[model samples]
Target: MIHLLYLLALLLCVAPLIPGLLGVVLPAASWLPPLGLNSPSAVAWQQLLSWPGLGESIALSLFTGLGSTLLALLFTFFILRRYWDTPQWRRLENTLSPMLALPHVAFAIGFALLFAPTGWFFRLLAASGLNTDNAINVVQDPYGIGLLIVLAIKETPFLLLMSIGVLQQLQVKRLLAVSTSLGCTHHESWHKVILPLWLPKMRLPLLAVAAYGLSVVDIALFLGPQRPSTFAIQVWHWFNEPDLQLLPRAAAGALLLLAITLSVLLGLRGLEWLLVRGTRAWQLNGPTASTYCGLVSTSHAVNGRYNGAGSPQTLHPALITRLRGCATALRRRIPLFAPFVLIPLLVIPTLLVWSFAQRWRFPDLLPSRYSFRFWEQELEPLLTLTGHSMLLALGSGLIALVLTIGCLEYKQRYHRAIPYWILAIPLVTPQLSLLFGIQVATYWVPGQHFGLWVFWSHLFFVFPYLYLSLEGAWRSYDVRLDQCSRSLGKTAWQTWWQVKRPIVQPAILMGLAVGISVSLAQYLPTQMLGAGRISTITTEAVALASGQDRRVMAIYGLLQGLLPLLFFGLAVFINRRTSRYSSPYSSQGHGPSDTSSTHSGSHHANDTVRG
Candidate 1:
């Protein structure tokens, strides 16, 4: 039965890639028989190469993709270095949940609201009597500066979350003690010892971020440039064009995108290789190296002579003055975190305010008038779209949860597991590239199953996330419970149901919530597979965001964010309740430590899920 279920899981999740790939490759080679281009040729590639702004579009994709990834990595490391293991670290961890829960699309909308030319920032400047006519352009800037910053800021928390597991495995305190004992300053310890160890483990998450930045369409549409958009956008445009003959060019563009994504991933891997193996000079440098010691001495001087508290007897006045200066500098620098956390909190209210505003002109702090008439007008369609979105999310989330459990069970029983790279493929690969092929494969089916296609496509994407989310739970779960149940004459299924299920239930629910968010955020899959026949909140929200209807956009954006937020809230509730119930079960193998393992494992499993 386990073997049969394993086969079924593979069929549901892994088998579809074949047709999806063929759907694009065949078309790219100009061999789509249905479209009447039977013979294979390079015409599509030629047209793609000859297209106007092709080079610029590719450059934009590379720049934003690689640039955002690098920035997010640096920011994540900096935050970890400054706050990890400190009293303030717990607050940073708490901050990550909301920021991580906020979907990229919703965040993009809010980002635009705050930074667009006539957005809140400029409005503030205008109110302050500054000349706002020459306001800096952020939304749709040619260089994709807005998109880069948004992606970096949004992805940093995710990297930090991923780092939790890696840092745990590294025995961070031990490493810090060892390094600092060797006369390395705290800063030098992180940069030299901790960073080298962390980077390699971070390879998968980094690739995920880079690939996402490259292929993201919805977020890019919200804030990316329009004239010569990113390469993914260019391909999306071609794919959506009315001309059927241009399908091959779109397919070719997809192929080009796949190549670029793969190349970037390989480049990242190579860079990791160089950092870890090829170049040891930087890693071998001493803590007291001339380059960093001067800076490190004044700042991370906790190890030199003064402990965390600068007591009079143990400290020199000169050292105390330097410490004071460092403390002030650090205090000034740490508020940088305020913008990342506060801006999103501010955006939520902005979205709420905009949704009800009757007329809110630029440079005005408050809406001149507010009414619910826009909500009244949008109520019916909004309900319908919300229904579709919710149904899709629930259906996909549940199914993916089931498949994940089965796969994990199979692995446990058989003492084998699916390769990490296979599981990671769905994440690191560009969704736009994969969906084009998947959409083509869907067309070969008989009738109009637009909703079914959307559900299945969502399931395909959601499976990996669910699997990754539950991986840590399954791994850390004490199989002794299973053995104890089995020894009492229960069947394997009975044991799993009676003994194993409850323990991992929290992780499962959280996985379901993650799956729902992923499904809810999907835009290209629904649009392509549904053939515009189905309209969910995301599709509607993205479409409306392009127009001048701020109220409607706000309504959908908030609704879009609200659905996932509710699920995450439920997951948290269930997890907390389960922890409370199982508090007495610590001696029986259920404990708070186990719960932490589950959450950490889930986070670790999908290190690249968000970014």
Candidate 2:
């Protein structure tokens, strides 16, 4: 039964990639029967190369994609280094859910409201009688800097969440203790010891971030440069063109996107290898030696305490020591959490105010006048779109959750697991690349199974996220509980239900929330597969984004962001209730220490589930 279920899971999740890729490959080669282009040719590639601003588009994609991933990575490392085992970690963890729940589209919308040329910031400045004409352009800037910033801020939470599991597996406390015994400060320890281990384990998450940054259509549509947009946006435009003869160019662009994504992933992996594996000197050099050398050579030079001959001179030793102490304290006290928490707080209210503002002009801290006319106008269509969005999200989330459980169970029993690359394919491959191919394959079917195809596509994307979310919980679970239940004359199913399910229920709920959010945020699958028939909140939000009506756009963006938060809230509520009921059983034979550990494990898993 487990074998069959495992096979079914694979069929649903992994098997679809073949047709998806074939769909793109054939079209790119100009083998479209509908277009009467049966023979393969290089005409599409030629056209793609000749397209104006092609180089700029590709450069934008690379710049934003790589740049965002790098920034997010550094920000995550800074947070972890400062607060990983500190009292602030718990508070940081609690804030992650809402941050993670905010869909990228909605975030992009709110970001524009705050940072655009005539946005709230400049308005506030204008109100203070300051010149606002020279305000730096952020939204839709020519350099793609705005897109890079949004992606970096949005992706940092995901990397931090992924780091939780990696840090746990590393037994960070023990590593820190060992390093401290060797006279290494926490700062040096993080760079020399923890970072190496963290990067290798974080390879998959980094690749996922990079891929999303490169192929993201919805967020890029709102915040990305317009004159020559990101590569993915260009491909999106090509696909939407009415001329059927240009289909091959779109397909070729997608193929190129896939190629670029793969190349970047490989490049990242190679860099990881060089940093962690190839360079042993940096990892092996004694922390004290490196620190002493760095401080004496640079710090003393800056302080004018070292002569040109590299000899130390007596120059206010007491003052220098005091200054060093102050610097260390200042570094440790840096407010790393400010931006992460503050941005979302600001964004939510901005969207809310925009949705109701009837007459809001520049340089005003608050709206001049507010009304509910926009909401009243959008109420009916909003309901219809919300219904469709919820249906797809819930259906996909539930199915993906079940399949994820089965796959994890199969791995536990057989001591075999699906290859990481197979799972990462759905994540690290460009969505446009895969969806283009998958959309072509859909035409082979007898009728327009648009809804089915869209749902399946959601499941396809959602499965990977659910799997990654649950993986940590499954790894951390004490299988001994199952053994104890089996020895008590319980069958395998009974043991799983009676013993294992309650312990991991919180993780399961959280994973479901994550899956739903992922499904809710999907724009390409719904747009391409649904053939414009299925208008979910995401599709409608993206569609409304191109218009001049900020009121209507806010309504959609608010709904888009709210749906995911609602699911997350629901999951958290259920998790708490289930935890209460199962507390007795969960604490059995496990004293306060073990109980605390179990709770922490579950909490970590919950934090890990976001997209």
Give one digit per residue, the lDDT tens place, for model 2 in 482-553.
888899999999988877888777678777888899899999999999889889999998888875698889
Name the candidate that leads on lDDT: 2
User: Worst 10-residue stretch by lDDT in candidate 2?
Assistant: 592-601
Off by over 4 Å in 2: 288-290, 293-334, 583-611
| Model 2: residue 495 alpha-carbon error in angstroms | 2.7
What digit string (tens of lDDT, one per residue) describes model 1 on residues 21-62? 888898999988778887999999999999999999999999
* C-alpha lDDT values of all predictions: 0.80, 0.83
lDDT against true structure, model 2? 0.83
Poorly placed runs, candidate 1 (over 4 Å):
291-333, 583-611
Query: Any residue pairs clashing in model 1, and if so which?
Result: none
Candidate RMSDs in Å, in order, are: 5.0, 4.0
